[model samples]
Target: MPYTPVNVSLTLTNQQYVALRTVNGTVVLPPGSSGRPDAGGLKGIIVVRQAGNSYLAFERNCPYRPFDACALVSVDRSGLFLRDSCCNSQFNLQGQVIGGPSPFPLRQYSTSLQGSQLNILN
Candidate 1:
């Protein structure tokens, strides 16, 4: 499924600069924390910090039913995978389908880290 192009650039200056949404609005995502900010991709972006300075970015749009409004994927509470309530599809952080009826993996964006700048693109 075609999705809105994503090009997100984040500058990490300190431990409290990363923003992530929560029940009480926005909160800080530490240098190693993973969360969905209220921007980027088709249904927003899920940013996951991997080993060391590496990171992974995935589109929140579920591939099962791309046009469905509820096809958006969110990080499951355990922070282990992404799930779509619309079709009950589950995907790993790498965007591979792990459960449910999804036939395709979540769209992954390319990421490049330069100094303190993290750029995600697709």
Candidate 2:
């Protein structure tokens, strides 16, 4: 059988959308940033970066146990991995856990860029 895809639309208020720039080819948005979809209490941030000639997007919530309040991740100047300052869990930019107690990778979101505008999909 052929696979079918699901379609969902999100509408955001002006206060929710914020413009950010990619530093050193990567930009990390915190949980309450603009690119994140605010639906169903889905809590996570989006990472927008330039990969070669394309842009990529990833969810900041660690996949091991997203509900864990401590699963939120942050990136540093190294442009390497996302670290959970609360519990010290570390995950690479690709969402792969590189250290700490995380057993899975971080969740990822689909992304599209048009005229410098990036759209992150949940």
Candidate 3:
């Protein structure tokens, strides 16, 4: 099964939306960093800053068990991949399944960046 999609419109600014709360603490990504924001999505939103102004947004829902409440992905301790503790599924920043039993990658959302604003949709 697939997860439900949501709309997200966020603006990155020092006083607007600068950091994201996480289990580790508030993460402040400069330009090329990955962080989970309290944004829209089935579970939540994980935003990764690529080279230049390119950005990637993904749903935190683990594809292995779409219906499970615990099927959520988080950035691993190494910060190299997103891990779903419920099923031990792992995915890279590009949403590629790299480990565990997951047969599909993480759900990616279309993102459009304009200046300091980012709009995400399914």
Candidate 4:
């Protein structure tokens, strides 16, 4: 099956996501931000805190399950795993498949931080 793709360009202000700088943040699409399609960034994005000022963004959909609503992933307890509700698969904050029935890792997007806004694109 083929999945439809949309061009995504989302910007989250720094002050709005200050907590994300130290903690993991996960928002589902279709209802995130302004509740717009692009608000949560495509299927959604998981903003992870890294060393220094670095941050990472990844697609919320599990790669193995593709585009079903059941494929939507979330940040699990311990704030280090992204788990897919459908299959209970687990992925690391970096989109790496840690422990799951899935053979592939989660999809990742590109993120660039400006002075006050964090750009999540591609």
lDDT values, one for every candidate: 0.69, 0.53, 0.69, 0.65
Model 1 RMSD in Å is 6.9
For residue 120, give model 2's deviation from the true position in Å: 0.7
Model 2 Cα lDDT, one tens digit per residue, 69-107: 766677755766678776677876667778988787766
The weakest ten consecutive residues by lDDT in model 3 span 24-33
Of 2 and 4, the candidate ahead on TM-score is 4
Clash counts per candidate, in order, are 0, 0, 0, 0
Please give, for residues 1-122, the per-residue lDDT of candidate 1 as tens digits.
Answer: 86576666777564553532222112212211233442477667677776667677887778897898888788787777779989999987677999999989988789888988878788
Score candidate 1 by TM-score against the native: 0.78
Instruction: Give per-residue lDDT, candidate 2, residue 43.
Output: 43
Model 4, which residues run further than 4 Å from truth?
1-16, 23-38
- Tens digits of per-residue lDDT, candidate 4, 48-88, equal 76765677777677777576768777888666678987988
For residues 2-107, could you state the per-residue lDDT of candidate 3 as single tens digits? 6555566667664544432222222222211123443567667778766566677777778897899898888888877788999999888788999999999887
**True-vs-predicted CA distance for residue 1, candidate 3, Å:** 3.2
Flag the better candidate by lDDT, 2 or 4: 4
TM for every model, in the order presented, reads: 0.78, 0.61, 0.78, 0.75
